[model samples]
Target: MDPLSEVLSLLKLRSYVSGGFDAAGDWAIRFGPHEGIKFHAVVAGSCWLSVEGELPVQVNAGECFLLSRGLPFSIASDLSLDPIHVSQVLPPNPSGRILSYNGGGDYLSIGGHFTLAEGQADLLLQVLPPLLHVRDQLGSATLRWCVERMRQELAEGQPGDFIVAQQLATIVLVQALRFYLSGRKAENPGWLFALADKRLCAAMAAMHATPGERWTLQTLARVAGMSRTAFAVTFKGTVGLSPIAYLTHWRMMQAADHLVSSRCSLAEIGSAVGYDSEKSFGAAFKRVMRCSPREYGRRQGGKGGPMLRSGPTSSSTHTGG
Candidate 1:
């Protein structure tokens, strides 16, 4: 599988559709820093997303964006408008119903949050930008389909709503990643850029496809069809890490996921990711995840359990796509 596919599969993200929102005239909503990733899709009308440290981006109908790293931001009709906290305007509604906020103009959108694997969000975040903007997804059938599915799931609240929504959310992120990578130049630096390089892509695919392989620089270089010296230089330059370092990161990410989602023994988990022993795996995991394997499981809400979903489950007001 491709690196992006591998990363998405390992994340085991749970998505919750937080209904929809409608606003008219002068209005802005501040979404506070959330624990999980948040996203917004403009179904009708337009808005400006003002994320700190980046210029406000104008999003029209059919456009969507993903905000990770829990950076607080505001969506407004205009950048000059004073914003109201989403909590203040939307308020809590015990009754799950469509929400509307009247200002003057008509705007419609749907939003939700994605809860990633416990103690392993940073591994995925490190490869993606803080903001992933998909301008005019109307032209992309895949994106449109995913959004429509999510909207339907949120609106109908059928028996399989949660499962369908979660699946759609994964598709949305995958499509968004494809959109971002396709738009970026080959020379760009980052994991995404690295995936674009044919030689590096070969090596990355190898690493992701078989994390337990006893991979060495020489073997990886052979996989990339490059000499050891050139592959090492290009891999580090393109991926921002040595080949071994990247492999370790990938292994630990897989280990973290298994630790939280499975009932396997620590030694089995370690061996699955190429570690020879449980002690070695624990050391590497601590170095990367900042916690011991047992501690990490506890922090993740205990072993062999579902990851906790963060953010608002049900809100008073929501607007549909």
Candidate 2:
């Protein structure tokens, strides 16, 4: 798999469109900052999206905005309007219906959150721009199609709608990432930069393709067609972690997957992820995932699967480069 696909697979993003809003004249809703990403798409009429530090951006019909870093922001008919909290505007009505917001003019939009379903979200999505604005429906047919599908599914539920909606949401997120990266000038250096490097891409592909392989520093450097020292320094500089560190993260991720998905013993899962013994694998998994393997598996299997604990709310924003 390609580097982007590889990373996304590890992330296991699960998304859903919820709480549709139909507003009219003088309306605004403030979304509090939280972990994960949020997206809004205008179906009819226009609205303004304003985050802290960035100028208010007008999103017309057929346009969409993605806040990748969960920065606090507000959407309104006008920037000067005092915003109502999203919770108040769209109360906890579990009926899954399009909510009507009547003030004066006619407007309609849909918004939702994209959550990392598994793996390490902070590390996997760290390279993404904080804010992504994609305009022009005609140019982005795939994105438009995904949004429309989601809208249709949300408005008129059917059998298997939940799974289909999730698949479409994934497509929307992937398209957003592609659209954001397409216009990137490569001014920032990180995984995006490293993915574009031919040698580094080769090395990453090898590591991802076969995490169970007995890979040494020398072996990985040879795969990248570089000397040991040069590859070590270059990999660390480009990826922000040593090659072995990255490998350990990947291995732990794989082990976590096995623990939740299969009934394999600890020893079996460890060996599958290149660990020689369960003790070594448990040590590394705890260091990376912040919990022991058994506890992680129990949490995953029990009621209410793992969720990122909410942190302090803030409006500080980071714009897309």
User: Per-residue CA lDDT of candidate 1, range 1-321, in tens?
Assistant: 788778767876677777678788888888888877888877779999998777899988777899987898999988888988888876656233346788433887778888877556676676667787898743467777777777677678688786777778777777777777777664435667777678899999998898888888999999999999999999988878899888888888887787677767777777788876667777888888788877776677544574423222221121110
* lDDT (CA) per prediction: 0.77, 0.75
- Expressed as tens digits, the lDDT of each residue in 1-321 for candidate 2 is 887788777677778766467888688889888778888877778899898767889998777888877789999998888999988866565655578878534887767778875556866557766767888644588877777777787778788776777788778777777766665654555665677678988888888898878777898999999999999999888887788788887778777777777767776777777776666767888998999888888888784554223223222221100
Off by over 4 Å in 1: 94-97, 103-105, 137-139, 152-162, 186-188, 294-321
TM-score, candidate number 1 = 0.83
TM-scores of the models, in the given order?
A: 0.83, 0.78
Error of 1 at 196 (Å): 2.2
lDDT of 1: 0.77
The CA lDDT at 183 in model 1 is 76
Question: Every model's Cα RMSD, please?
Answer: 9.9, 9.1
